[model samples]
Target: MLRFNLLLCFLFLLPGKHLFAQNQTGKRYKIDRYNSIYLPLGEISFADKLVQFKVGNPPPIKKYRDSTQCLHEPNYRNYQTPNFISLGCGGTLTVAFTDNGFMNLPGDDLYIFEVGPSREAAKIEISQNGKEWVYAGKIAGGKSSIELSDAGIDNETVFYFLRITDLKELCRSISAGADIDAIGAINSVIKLTINADVLFDVAKYNLKETAKESLDSLAKIIKKVDKATILIEGHTDSDGDEISNLTLSKNRSISVKERLLKIFNNYEGYDFEVKAFGESTPRFPNDSDENKQLNRRVEITVLPPKDYYENLINK
Candidate 1:
């Protein structure tokens, strides 16, 4: 009888043990403000509950410690119903948010973090209804933590998230007041800014053999963000007559557009707007050879909506 009771006890506990292990499989971890990753030792949920440390204080750990020793912050930065996207690269991570999702905020803040081997860079963009994206500018860098505040977000569902493509290993934790949706506004612009002199034969509109390298880079950026309205703007130095310079710039810009279209032949439902400014927009003064070299350039700016630009600038 004693042996039988022991056997019964073993059977009863077996299922419970298995279930407990399974429950911990999908547990979320935190990457705290101090740039540490921590697992929760206590029960934690996002539903009206705050994450508190077992010892009642923020846990301190050595900088750049192993993942297991790191602790994450419990509270997430609050937003005014905006949408965002984040991307991580080698020792850096970037997060961007737009004001077109929840509350039509004008400016969106991009959060950048440098953790380990990755370096972070962020570009904040805006759109009227999340269907377009316009460049704002590069946000300030060199922070372990940042909050993208002061963007003019109105009461519309703003779309935002992160794009984490460059890093070998990536992980994240987000505490949001509102539910996150995967659906985002389709981007409609492809902008490319390349140093023209570096890409062409000297004093000629024709592309040098080495120019393909730059074009190849442009091709890659375009491939990642497919389906965009392409605007190709060509610029030239202030050396020759304005009319001749404009003509050369226009030809060069057209050449780039044609090559891109051929390379991305399979991408359908996209339009192209090719224009030549011809020495109109000089990136640098034409006083020296270096500056003149800089002046001869191409700019691919995606024209989203007016509100998109407004939001980006305001943010």
Candidate 2:
């Protein structure tokens, strides 16, 4: 996970809107304040116009997605096996997804998942027309990412074909060459919010049974991307003592992180952090139980790989 430099703003009074906290170490944190946009939180696995895919022929014909254990389609929502287009030396796999052309974003535009720990390297290419190809770059098979911006594609330009040519040898069985679990996209998404009620039980830091299932799905989707930074923050209604409220919020966030860790513990390169906002920031007025419930929750924000934000500096 890449770190970004946030501007240091003081603990100014925004009244009921936001609050910043200072730790014993003198670092100011903003887990308590948030922008009230109507966006769903937790995980993001966006689906675009995916048309078709082809595996280079020694002919098992179909590859991973065809035999998917994914409970959901398009997004591949579940922690299934590395459903890849396993290729051997000189083998290739190609897919087509439409948005016209991938645009520039704070992060990658495409994500390709493969067997990890030991990875396979592949040559990547894109095409506006099936016959014409443009080399985007090379990707090593685990959770390899692609930003069309890095390939000189203009924003909003719709180029269709995504071709991955294998360049590595099979490490395990010969049939287990480059195992690709899934493919996804990245855009200008900087934050994702999940409703706390969906993740926790009332007055509990432990996840509900269903919440664990939901998080498992999210973990599968997110685990496909490389270099992810998971930030979990908890919030509460303004009913308890501020000190205790802070503790509750912190615990709740940690709860969510713990669930994710259950599924993601294998990815040692990813970063995870938990923070607390307590009752400082509320999404709705605490005028009723419904509003208070909305305020009392946890938030998870994933900062895309550092290369995502590097677009600004490169610009």
Candidate 3:
């Protein structure tokens, strides 16, 4: 499930982590939100679409700038009420986005919708300033996606532009080229979390300098949330004396809250509450060092007020 949270709450896990089965404790899996690039902040430029590629009025580039990646889904065509077609043959299209470029990450996808009756082939390309373009490669009509690494281009290449060109020769009717519905700079949600060991020394609550970067990034996100309550939770493994463990958890949660306040105090419209679970809320048994490390952590959860949604809708 793609949660609307736009940023990762912690560093992402390695591949196959998503398939990991949950233990009997009922701990929900975390969603990855690190690399998400919000769309509606992009535009399609220098595009050509066949007359048949569009059902009625001239195709608007705006149609393909949304989050919808409706390919092969019959009910969704052209992205809007009118379906889409290709440029017949030799037609090309390009989309420019705000992100410096897409990253070379595992399971990344560039979604594109293809029209039917017949599948067609198309060439894809990437660019930095839009003036200089690089070959990305061919995309089959029905696959509905492209791999960023397939271009095998420099991972440093900041991708601001995407191009698709129809390859079919001998012009057919209309809709010969590739028809598109939407494209995304990213494909999944991102999560951000900091390991307790990394953020603090053993049995200590104060954050180390190494933890500053992560909290800085988190602070920016909190500011962006604008209006919301925050929940600062402190957790600990089943180690040391039980009373000390509970006190350590409380002090640690307070430490994080104080640091965040120093950074976010300038802003208004927000408040926070603090709580500590001690060893009672073990994500995993503290039978192993690794599990113990996992148990000792602090979490920040953004809580929008009850009327937050209602207020936005009424606005």
Candidate 4:
């Protein structure tokens, strides 16, 4: 079985929690011993790409109108700070975690760094792909966190994209709407995505011969990690019945895991886990052929070692 608690302490420490560990190199590391999530800011990974942005009817000043400002980590320190982007009333913005993503864990899975004192709120939604979204509730201005489990989403689900729409609750500030500094994943994972069509025939779980190259490349990447739990999740389109789709997804994930294990037979410092979501979690709606193809895929999430963030913080 996979250990979910192992990475919890390393990912995001509770409001006053702290962890200290010493590696073989006699180096001590600290993950997050600070107050709010923004303390670690640029040190750790956060949403990296700005996918889409639309200013509402009442736009913010030109200084705070740059959508790219919301990319990466939050840099807003005070009301006078200009590091964040302001979405006008009823504005919307979407961001992507290119290198890492968040999955449901013990507590809050995501956080929003919405600066200012107005307590502006935003309708927050999450997605595996950028198209289909799951309402994960709202972030009430300032620095707020939301648990993915609260939305009744699958624990095995990992989201790469996040969409935030300004509720226009408090548009009093000069920035208006919601001033977003950054979005961070509390339960973060290093993700690698591969289209299912590349690995199998139509509706089949068996790995095609062509999958060898992809798996080979994946294995090489996995070997580079010092220590981690590897999660192999399989997903499919909604063409088949629920049970059949679920079984197919499970077998597909198992197939991928088995192949990777063969290469890692003599390998150490890693634990492999498999999960299947079938049509339960679609990155995109199955209405179109292209979208269906996009939904049929596999996501490999690499949970960092217990001391992964510790090492990162120390660096």
Ranking by lDDT: 4, 2, 3, 1
The residue-by-residue lDDT of candidate 2 on 1-315, one tens digit each, is 122222233333222122213211111111112311111111233223333444433433243434232111223222243343455444566665432123354445665554433577777787766578888776763436677778786663345566667664543443344555444444423344567778776667777788887787666555444455676778988886898988888888888887777665444535687889998988899999899888987765554445335544697
Pick the lDDT winner.
Answer: 4
lDDT of 3 by residue, 99-208 (tens): 12353334433545454445567777777667788887676745555666777865433455666676664245444455554444432111234577777888898888
lDDT of 2: 0.55
- After superposition, the stretches of candidate 4 with alpha carbons farther than 4 Å from their true spots are 1-34, 38-45, 141-143, 190-213, 219-227, 232-269, 274-299, 304-315
Compared with the true structure, model 1 gives a TM-score of: 0.42
lDDT of 1: 0.43
Question: For every candidate structure, what is the RMSD over all alpha carbons to the true structure, in angstroms?
Answer: 19.2, 17.9, 17.1, 10.6
lDDT, model 1, position 192: 51
Better candidate by lDDT, 2 or 4: 4
After best superposition, candidate 2 residue 214: deviation in angstroms?
1.8
Candidate 2 has its poorest 10 consecutive residues by lDDT at 23-32
| Candidate 1 stretches greater than 4 Å from native | 1-190, 302-315
Kindly list the per-residue Cα lDDT of model 1 for residues 206-293, writing each as its tens digit. 7888888788777765543322355688889898899998888888888888777666553443356778888887877789998987
TM-score of each: 0.42, 0.40, 0.41, 0.61
lDDT of each: 0.43, 0.55, 0.54, 0.76
